[model samples]
Target: MITITTADAIIHTLESPEAIADIPSPNTRAALQAAYDAGHWELYEPPQAEPEPLPPDWPAFRLALLQSASFRLWSEALPATWREDLKLAAIAANAEALQSIYTHCTTLHSPGHTAATEWQQVADHHRIPITF
Candidate 1:
């Protein structure tokens, strides 16, 4: 079994026939040619794909989101009743309330929305699943 590097080199040399002369070993060249003729170039094992990353730490994310300046500002800007309701929902860890908040922030183009978007992008880039 050849290493991945050797397999790649073989494939490259086969594809570029002129490069075959550069290969010092006659046996290696013959093997490469035979493999190519047999359409077995891909018979060599491929590199393993990277594993999918685990989801972000939900509790930590929630805490950070709740404590964010954007969230604070959004809450402060709400009417008295709505503000109280939002606080209660947050305390209760209501999923619907969180979704509602996200929707509202997005609709209003609030700073909270920007913060959420940034956080989401960062999470995606790090291969972390974003629950929110």
Candidate 2:
């Protein structure tokens, strides 16, 4: 299970600029600050999704991370920037992504190499690692 522990920590520090000032990821901290500056740092209950929908914008999506750190982010709050260095660490996270990864794990556990490869292919087909 890929337990994204950092997301929760990021949300906790949202209220206090000084609190999130020093965390593991500098970009995460900056995103939180941007959210605070934009006045959308407060948490919110993510919309219930049958299969988890991806947010339209990645930067906005990154800021909306909550205590539970749901995959969905407030796309409207994202800043307008095209910086190549700007990337979202959790953009690939969602129920569908989890399920796909889980399926790959299960296939690997079953000792079915070919099936596991297929599942792995499906999982890797769209997921792009964030580079910062």
Candidate 3:
């Protein structure tokens, strides 16, 4: 099992401005700052993007979230950027691996070989690491 032992720490580290500097767009910055300032946030819903397919354990993970008040509250309070990041991460992950990554956010670990790796399995794929 690919477990992320310190997901909150990893979220904080990845959420740093310096970490996501290459995402582009001033809107992203404003949105992220607003979420931070308010101490509450929601996922971004851009028209062009869509949620990825879930893996085997997705239902279990979702059930866990629904069953846990803490996770529900925290997830509800997540910033838009974080939501978008989650979506992107989902897009970059395998259908069978989505639940582990999403539910294990607090653990901070990412899949070793995922959609991103598969998409970028060639020299030409380097044009954009940010594109899902």
Candidate 4:
């Protein structure tokens, strides 16, 4: 089962066998549903469908990200050694890696980050980078 731990809650793919119990337990469907309503779990369906691959423009978008003032600004705050690490990580050009770099580069509230859907699509397209 794939699970994403977010600031809000523990999200589980409905498709994952571990997402819910076969039979109803104390916090069974009800709990899961509640969590879903509250944006906790990823989704409620047991076996979730795989997300689509990223569009071909992902690399362009990634390049644009590196050029953003926020990224440059974020990098400026880092130690010289950490800046090199960020540079190496950016070379992967994976969706997750870009987001991670962005998170480190700018405030979480900054705009222009990729959406969850895009993340999935790129991940699906570049499986080798993610290797999940």
Candidate 5:
């Protein structure tokens, strides 16, 4: 009359010869042993929890956003050399220049302002700490 809640408990009970012998009914003892030997007890594993999603790769994401068509079009108003310099600064991870660019892009009534505003919302949603 073992109170079995899990497969581990069944395994523990099976390990004790004395406990098996103490079972007064031969049919019950044979059935328990048969169930163990047939591997039916292996099917009762506890459900595994899903792993949490990883955070975004912010540096890569920011760089990609900067390279997007909208950003490129916005920066086209600048001279060719300055546009190249901007790309280089982004590649070099110049935080000050990136912050300045973010501020400039998000200016009201500016070209590509809508795209910049959407980007700012994404940054906010991700709790990015960059100050503009």
Candidate 6:
């Protein structure tokens, strides 16, 4: 669950400042100003770590691959030293397999089912990458 904070609330409210007179509290107002200076508000409580994604059944695996861009913008921004640490290669490989399956198997057109099935062929030796 997400816990939004006083700072987040105040900044969001600042879009229309004309209607309100005094802002809530000096502390909250300061936090809001600080957040604005830093570019965004901080979460009151950071989000709980998401449970890791299970190795996709074949079809689901296929879909994520098909959706990945040739050069993912998210991954590209990382420093070159950290590129391999990102572990996008596994994702790219899975995507390639999915695309191959789709191109080869004329019959199974559903992205989910097809991806899952193709994944089964690879599941024994390799596990999917898990990110924080």
Candidate No. with top lDDT: 5
Tens-place lDDT digits, model 2, residues 1-132: 011124335444233456666667888766666666656555444557698644344334344333112121222123323111122223555544434543443333342455445433433443422211
Write one digit per residue (lDDT tens) for candidate 5, span 55-77.
Answer: 54566656666756766666776
Q: Rank the candidates by lDDT, best first.
A: 5, 1, 4, 6, 3, 2
What's the TM-score of each model vs. the native?
0.41, 0.22, 0.24, 0.31, 0.38, 0.21
Error of 4 at 27 (Å): 46
Name the lDDT of candidate 1: 0.55
Q: What TM-score does structure 1 among the candidates reach?
A: 0.41
lDDT of 2: 0.40
Q: How would you encode candidate 1's per-residue C-alpha lDDT over 38-90 as one tens digit per residue?
A: 55544345589999867445456556656667666665776666666655655
**Superposed Cα deviation of residue 6, candidate 4 (Å):** 47
lDDT of each: 0.55, 0.40, 0.41, 0.52, 0.56, 0.43
Q: In model 1, what are the clashing residue pairs, if there are any?
A: none
lDDT of 4 by residue, 15-100 (tens): 55354555267555566655645555443436678899654454554465465565556566677766776566656555576556
Tell me which residue pairs clash in candidate 5.
none
* Model 4 ranges off by over 4 Å: 1-52, 55-58, 94-132
What RMSD, rounded to one decimal, does every model reach?
Answer: 9.3, 25.1, 26.9, 16.7, 9.2, 17.4
* CA lDDT for candidate 4: 0.52
lDDT of 6: 0.43
Q: Give the TM-score of candidate 2.
A: 0.22
RMSD of 5: 9.2
- Most TM-score-accurate candidate: 1
